[model samples]
Target: MGEPVRSLPHLVGRRLSRVVVLIAVILSGLLLGAGIEAQEADNSTANLPTDAESAVAARVQERLGTAEFTPAIVVFDRGGDALTDEDRDVVQRKLSELQELAAPGQQVFPVLAEDGQAAFVGVPISAETPEEELAEPVAALRDAAAEGLPEGLRAQVTGGPAFIVDLSQVFDGADVRLLAVTASVVALLLLLTYRSPWLWLVPLSVVGVADQVAVQVVAAATQVFGFSTDGASVGITSVLVFGAGTNYALLLIARYREELRLVEDRYDAMRRAVDRAAPAILASSGTVVLALLCLGLADNPTSRNIGFGGALGIATAVGYALLVLPAAMTCFGRGLFWPFVPRVGDADPTRSGLWARVGHAVTARPVVVAVAGTLVILVCAGPALGVKVGLSETEQFRAEPEAVTGQLVLAEHFPAGSSQPTTVIVATEDRDRVESGVARVQGVQRVESAGEGEGSAVLSVVLDAEPASADAFAVIEEIRAVAAQQSPGALVGGPDAEALDASDAAARDQLLIIPLILVVVTLVLLVLLRSVVAAAILVLTVVATYGASLGASWVAFRTFFDFPALDLSVPLLGFLFLVALGVDYNIFLITRAKEEAEEHETKEAIATALAVTGGVITSAGVLLAAVFTVLGVLPLITLTQIGVIVGFGVLLDTLLVRSVLVPALVTLLGRRFWWPGRLSHDGRHDGRHDGRQGSPAGHVAD
Candidate 1:
């Protein structure tokens, strides 16, 4: 008689109980460390500003008089032909009202600019100004501008601080909408896949717990480390944490159910499930974790933080999957696969009509199938060459009234490049000469000499394009070239040009990092699988999938959404995530295929692998896609980019790469795919029990 399924779980339970105690102890320490880190992280901001940012601030201080750029700007148009008596009166009153908004520690500067038609009253916010202090002052200023205005004139206000506050207030509602939609769709998909509410709870509950742990831990860590999130990146955190967590849970549960179907006693089923599934899940999670950690190599603070947070999430999911999942499965036992409980029978590969056809087609003309699949990938990759890279923050709220108003004001008064333009600072003993040199540079609309000292002079060079644009890079290089000839002694430094330069340099660095990380990661897989050829092909397939996904995202965003080219970092991130996590499905499917091949013939092997592993990978992919879709619904362009790119990327990985590409490629390659391994040369391996049983059955049994 077959070994009782209960026996598997009993074995697991005996071993796991001991490990659980040790885990509890380690978890306690991590929790305490996290608590301490949380406090430290919260205060971390105080310790930072040491490097380039601080240097930039010091340079700006010379001409700006220590009055840093107030993130708040004031706008009130004067009556026609400059301010009339009435306009003057209104402006004075508005200024008076704005004074009341100034908190004890805050500073607000009132200024005026008049064109032929009207005048705009403005304010520059200080660096350390608090939102609470700015809100009331800004609101009062707006009210004053609104009152006593000339008939044709109107008053409006906009600024980064205000935008953040506005987005924050509305984000709660947006998040609510996002969560409701995500939960509904996900629940529907799960129910459809499982056909049982009882089994569906496993993934839902697991993902929910994992989400809490990831978010809370990341929040607590950032707070302790003193990392503050940008408004857009803040929204992204939710989608990433939940989406990845759910993907992990679905894979684990699917494997558990599949194992339970074959092993009768519930306990043994869970143990076998853990043994069979955990390795692939862990492998996938490990690759992702390592890739994210690679983000630490970035010079940009934003990229660095994202990398840290992402790595943390991947790591947490790995831990939960290996430990908590086992514990929970042990508790549920046979009931875990309830409503469609396994009948202690082998899976029948030919049971599904769909599988029968796919199996026949795959083996019938493997070359034709492989060539056709390759053609599809090459065709989809065409748009990738047209991809561009840049971001417009205002695009986040293209439909919002405030964003529209803000854009109008900026276009009318400010330089088109005013949104964080690249400032080229040429410091020299001859300040006046350096300023003249900067002004002469092509594309430089204006140059302001800042600071007064014996050794230094800071010149702010405003370019004609947004700082993140390719044009801006050209402008910066022009300024540098001109300044080098004119001011041989000047030190050039500013946030605008420096940030762009750093980002470009970082992108180059990632190119090298990708291959290095890939080799290291693939090596790990190689050791685990003990097959060099399998490792090489797996990496190659994942790369193809990533490229296809990126190309598709470029078209979707650029053509459909009318977004600018994909984010510069998207390719790097896409490579890391798809390559790492994408390989998980490969490991799951291929390993199973190998086991089947050991016992059954090649045709039967491919059929059996798909029957057992396909459903689980598909479910996992959908869950991941649902979670990522939350990013698309957010009101920020950055998150939206991340959402669509990753969501589509995962889909491509599952539907195309995992489902067709890898399987077809493996079938075409056949035994050659596992070269140098003992299994490849010999027709036997101990892992396959089918051979001993004479291949009596070669199909999934429901």
Candidate 2:
């Protein structure tokens, strides 16, 4: 069947060769994955377009020869009670020590809030500090703030620099944690799917090794490419390797088990299984890789890097699954299945079960089933219309870190936007004019000259609203507009302005990349399934699945998680993952159904296809969903939101859309479902029970 494709699995068929490949794969994974530890773990970017105003504002300072320094806010609070004189004395005593932590060209200054209950020390740390060494200065400041502190007064090191440190810290041991959790989840699911204890180990170990190897590859790629990657991307990549890699394993092993029933020789069975299933596996991986690579067109640096890293990981996973995994499986004997071992004459257990009945039920009333499934998807998607986009800076964390709390405290006790003020850079000659214009703006509370260097001057404008709020963003827009009118080259930036630009960039990227990804995926489906009708149907179903999953997840986020708004990247990233991964089940099911159609009527073929592929796809889907859910282990809100959305999307796609709706559509379409393909008019069919009465005989669940 795979004559055009060389049986790469069998190349390692020699007893010694199989063992050699297996051992080599494991060692490579270990040594290479360990190398990731040497690569820096912090790769996060603001995820904004480089040409945006905020980005230009950031660069203006560098060009003006002023060192880039980010402030670390040292916040001290006395709860509802006003700060006592003793509390003020302690802050005074620590001010000199905190100044020691500031960057060489910067200094620290203590300022008491008007409310007298909170005070802050703004400590500037050089932005040029290497990512690995960023925490050292922040840590020293935090230690100084904590020791010899008087009772009833507490302090937290926060603001931009501290936020960066905390965010990176959240991923300190995330790889090991995610790997351990993902591996354990995979092992458990595999063991359950194949009742034999020994059977589960084969695919788990193979996929596990692939995930570790992917980590090393991703880390190395980051160094060579110098693209912005972060701990969250690293975590997501590992999850993808385990989830998608193990899925390939499940599909392969299921076919292998089925083939074992007809082919007595275990080695021969493995070869036949690889020959039949490899194409679908390859097609599935191709679509995902291509779709992920489309992220290269994204404006967000993190999005582009994620696409690159995820694509590399998927390629690595598929390579190992098709090559190393097959060799590893063949090294074992039939006894690997233990009491459930397949015999040449034994009944294929997958022909009947929850899936067989579902097939029967679907065939009985294709129109009704199709209508009902569409309604479910539509209902799930309703809430999406009201979904909000763009979480505030402090909202980026699921669990409030000291930075977030400090920002809140600062907001409560000080003037509006006291925690962080918007920065504006302009030509030194026009600084006074631009500053005067900005000061007269409706939202401007005050404008202070930061410094001047070369031919440029910097202004820190305190706005009349909390940082990153809608009001603050509005103020930034007004400030920018005024700057453009009074001083054309003035650049406005800082936390609030950067976030504003990021939101706009995310919107722009969505418009550009979404259609591009859809086109890529659609073209891939068109190639994989030769029938235009089938390809169109699969693409529509995947779209519906994405919409439904996003809508449903938005509801969950609001109702249970109480999230204010989705991160700017969530909707686009969620759509990308759902579309790419959702097509996997379509490829698996429809390809199998196509094969069955050669020998059976259309309705009967689809029913039979469902019974056979149901168990494996369902198992794989649930396992993948669970692995994604493990992202909840990290504290970042963006990652958590992604995990929930994608996880739920996978479940919805696997359990409903693939299992019922698509099959029903095909059943109703009859032979026309395969129109333009040989199966529509040619090939063999027994014409037994044309899908109205008896469904295909057999249970397909594992």
Please give, for residues 1-702, the per-residue lDDT of candidate 1 as tens digits.
122122123324655644663574466456645643322121112112334442454456545453355435555553334546676566666765665554445555554543533344445555455554555655665666577666866776665555545555445566457656666666777788778767667566555555556665777767776554543444454555566666666766766666666767665666666666666666677777777777666555555566677777777766766667666656555655557765667564334746456655676777877787778777777788887765534444524645346545554655655433444444555667767877777777787754444445556666666544567667766766777677663444443455455556556646766886688678867876677888898888788877777788888887788886555555666676667767877877776676666556555666567666777777777777667766666666656776677778788777777777677777777767767665565454323543453221211110
Model 2: weakest 10-residue lDDT segment is 693-702
State the TM-score for model 1. 0.83
Instruction: Compare the candidates by TM-score and give the number of the best one.
Output: 2
Q: What lDDT tens digits, residue by residue, belong to model 2 across residues 266-384?
A: 77777777877888888889998998898888888778878988999999899888888877887888888897878998888778877888888998899999999999999999999
lDDT of 1 at 633: 69
TM-score against truth, every candidate: 0.83, 0.94
User: Could you tell me which residue pairs clash in candidate 2?
Assistant: 43-229, 350-699, 350-700, 351-698, 351-699, 352-698, 352-699, 611-700
lDDT of 2 at 701: 11
